[model samples]
Target: MIISASTVKDTSENVEKFVRRNLLGGIDHLVIFLDAPLPDVEELLDGHPDVTCVRAHGAWWGSTPPGGLNERQITNAALISRLVVGFVWAEWMFMLDGDEVARIDRPVLDALAPQQRAVRLLPLEAASRLHPVADPTLFKRLLSADELQLLHALGVIAEPKQRSYFRGHMSGKPGLRPSADLALGVHHVVDTGTGDRVDTVKDPGLRVLHYESHDGEEFVRKWTALLSSGLDVAQHKKRAPVAASVAALLSLGLPEEQTASLLEELYERTALDDVESLTRLGLLVEVHPDEGPRRPRPPDDEVAQLRELLRRAADVNKRMFKPRARNQRAPALIAKLQRGLR
Candidate 1:
């Protein structure tokens, strides 16, 4: 089965590591869509025969919605999806965010090979090593398998919790059939025919390592980018209050320096100490290394079923409901009008 993976990234940090990890995980090809110009992109792709890089030149930016999906994610789903479908000849395709890494095994690959099937992976959020103010370059440094093990052993970073307060945490990226008419998301795919999400292969073996907020500098940069983009503050007001507040503040002409400072303070107050404390308390468990083949989930064909159901409903409606006569009136009403005229 031909399986390919694609991601749209602007930053140089973790790009090489992300590509290498997917290649090692048995993905047949890697397509990188650069949202912004990265100078070392050519050198980065030089040795990898399977990897391809394409620069978007801000085409993806204009497609961003006011509320729902961010520009980067929309670009990935709408822009990169087309690119992958057009050029890459693959039975199944996986979408990865710039900071996310997929850990796919043999059985998972086998599960993904079937037609009319999509596999949803789990997400593991990685914790940062440095606190307060940390360098962005620290994220660029590749963490060896041994180093990850050591960090887990030392309780510096713990395995991601299976549950999240955020929506769609359990339902991660979809490995989709390329031919399906669908609108892709980071966690799910909406079938265009039925306007419903395609059923997912609910296998625990498929996991994505999400290195969100790698360091203070990176965190600031990410938030700054979002704030500057004029992201809809009202959209995230309930789901993410802090983000909404930041957006509101920026929109109100909050200076960049002041906004950055506020964000740093908020980060320190909210996540930094809490993460350390939780690790110390052993609230977050360490994920053990697994060398065995991962298990495959049964195929789900709910998308096809839903599409058929919708078609039948439409047909039934068309046959049962007839158009009214243009000038027809109720018999009693017509008689009353005639008597009134007389």
Candidate 2:
């Protein structure tokens, strides 16, 4: 089994932690393909002595090949990895993004067969929801390399229409391999950057943590800069808005689901009149901008206003001590004001 990772510095911590935790007794070789600069690559290798590290120009192992204005750095990396798999005599070659981790319940080598094309390991997804809890689910896996060349050939080209078919080709079969009995799951920790504190996966002893969600502004900056140099510029930029929203929501003490709802309320302008009232009463618990003023108090103006309102109600009640004729307006006004106070 070969563990391969291609990444920049932002994800280095997650990759390092994942490798340290999961690369246990049976793994024959641990290979990390660093797509960052040589200096960053050396930095990643500084502490991780158990894993073998290789520096590369780009990520090509599990992604589409570059074309047109896009450079072929990724394509070259893919080709190199394919060759390594074939030549290294690896029975099982597992490829993943640097932020992604593979969690196995049973030993991986025990599942391999002599003539199998490739095994599809699924991921368990961890995400935050509005209910103040985490949601965990199973994710799909990529092909185990039976024929590296075939997989590599398809990877260099964009095949949105052919993705499923490509998986079939990797399976070396007509369509998807029907393996209902042995469903190896992948836990995609895609929304690690989410605000809601939800546990995404069940208590399945098997799950991999994909650290894509944990990335912050620095990660975004580095990735966009690197990918923009010679890769798909738009693809790298697409994550910005979502990432920003996630960061903003986290700043708001609300859970993921509540944040989304609050955002929706903000968009609809439904929070306008009630905003002041809620804030005054301490009913609104919005995250302060810049973490400023953690200990919040009701505004003096609001407190004064409430006091004046109560005083006016008490004065009116005292003035209307006796019930007047049914036709009198003073009693009606007093009743209306009292109702309003309630």
Candidate 3:
């Protein structure tokens, strides 16, 4: 199996330890791509057998002299290369973050005995706003290089949660888009629970617990540091308000009413869920509008609806104007419509 990650030094140790304990009986090999905390990784894999570690940088391009490539584009390039390599030769491979761990009750090989396809479905377990996840899993299908490139073109990997591309094939309201294609789930713990280590995976039979949020600090430091060096750190740092709202909701446990108010205010200028997500990272901040009263927020139920409407509007606007999608203002418009409906 191939697992790809960049800037995952902190959490990868735990993941590696967990994998060593759990996964067994493999005839071929296991390859892991890790980008930072070189010494720590070496320590974790010191005596492990049948494991190959690549001192990989997330960037598709090679390292940047002593520092290594820092930009997201560069990291994406590296991931694509790994995907290409795995798709060609490997029977089954995984694309995941360092903070992520693939969990199963039995051996991974046993799970694959029934499936005959080139790509087997794996589960993705992400934390839920209401409950602490116990066994998080997802049914993920393996992809070839061409399919990976298609997903990249569709903005799946770059911004995985945005459901704009496949919305037509989706159902359910504004919450987690449910799919019957495959049952694989990802237990995303990064922004869900209090401090990220609260088991949020729902299925106990097959589970993977991601400890990256707390463990991957080393990677966080390195990548952002690189970002600060290469680009305008101050500008990247402007995402504070969005980050703060999520903290207020999940960490502080603000009441639904208060949370709704904060989300409403944020939705006027941005997506409420986006603000909540950013807030979970503790990276949100308020920014003044250039003109007008700015965006307005609707009732709680309408928050996600507004986001979807905004996304659709943005798609429509893009086709009509053919203008670049620079911090697109469609979210603001949806916020306005939602407020009007309310």
Candidate 4:
């Protein structure tokens, strides 16, 4: 059977969406470790047959305080991955994030060769806020050499340094064979007994759709905490450039509103701004996101209602095209960031 694990500190709505979507994607059970003191998800999935919510106050997180969020995730994933063998009959267990949803129609491990101990699912990052194809969300992925050339030729990314195609991670997450003495690390699976990384088979068909901060409000909300929290995320390869910029911005200690204002243009430029061009170029793929909840919910948690508001009102979508020159408003932001760097 297919199972998944995650450490989430998200609102009930997003949690509900993630659970239902993954369940529909063929995950038999989801082991969710609550990393927050209070988020409505535990009550939301109180007795879900297919979900187990391990609270922060429970014996789980109580053993020791995690050094940081990523540490917590790594710990939780390893804990459940090792522990799941006792209670559940599972073949593959995926460790992803609350902001991520696996695009697995049927996660079958039985067909995998005996040596294929783990599977890697590359992420397709959410780029647009609204698309005619909102059945799922519009996400950007790493292009092939030819596609990368097309992007450069069309000036989609403009400078090589400007965009990394996918903004979050390229290493991907793993789906491990639980019986293989496996533990989920930050990005891949490891043999707990030997402390060696497992050989991973990268599945192009199976992927993780990441809904990172798609707007300025979300962009600030997500990054401000990390940049200022001393998480040392700037050392992360994919995140270093932007993380450094945001950390620099935070050092300025400018008013919250000013920081957000400065980041507006930067967010637009780095985010997948032109969906139409990407789609035409076959750089975007569409998946249908499940709107129904795994369990019955209050009025606010309904999918039919949430989907429209989420698409048309709450979130915004943008077109894809050539990367443009930096906006006039961004220079002061840059100057201030430079000052912070000093």
The TM-score values for the models, in the order shown, are 0.60, 0.39, 0.33, 0.75
TM-score for candidate 2 = 0.39
lDDT of 3 by residue, 163-231 (tens): 321211111100011111111112121111122221222222433333221212222342344343443
CA RMSD (A), model 1: 15.4
Candidate 4 lDDT by residue in tens digits, 1-342: 566878777678778888888876656667677776654677887656566666643444334444567766776566445443432345578988887887664534556787777888888887754222333466778667777777778877764432456667777778877652567766877765556778888766778888777555567667875664446786677677777777687788899788767777667765545766888887777666674333223232222222222122111111000012113342343233224122
Residue-level lDDT tens digits of model 1 in 303-328: 22222222222211111111121112
Provide the lDDT at 281 for model 2: 35
Better of 2 and 4 by lDDT: 4
In Å, residue 342's CA in model 4 sits off its true spot by 59
* Sequence-dependent TM-score of model 3: 0.33
Order the candidate numbers by lDDT, best to worst. 4, 1, 2, 3
Regions of model 1 farther than 4 Å from truth: 1-9, 58-72, 75-89, 111-116, 128-170, 230-234, 237-240, 247-261, 280-342
The C-alpha stretches of model 3 lying farther than 4 A from their native spots are: 1-7, 11-13, 21-29, 57-89, 103-342
Ranking by TM-score: 4, 1, 2, 3
Candidate 3 vs candidate 4: which has greater lDDT?
Answer: 4
User: What TM-score does structure 1 among the candidates reach?
Assistant: 0.60
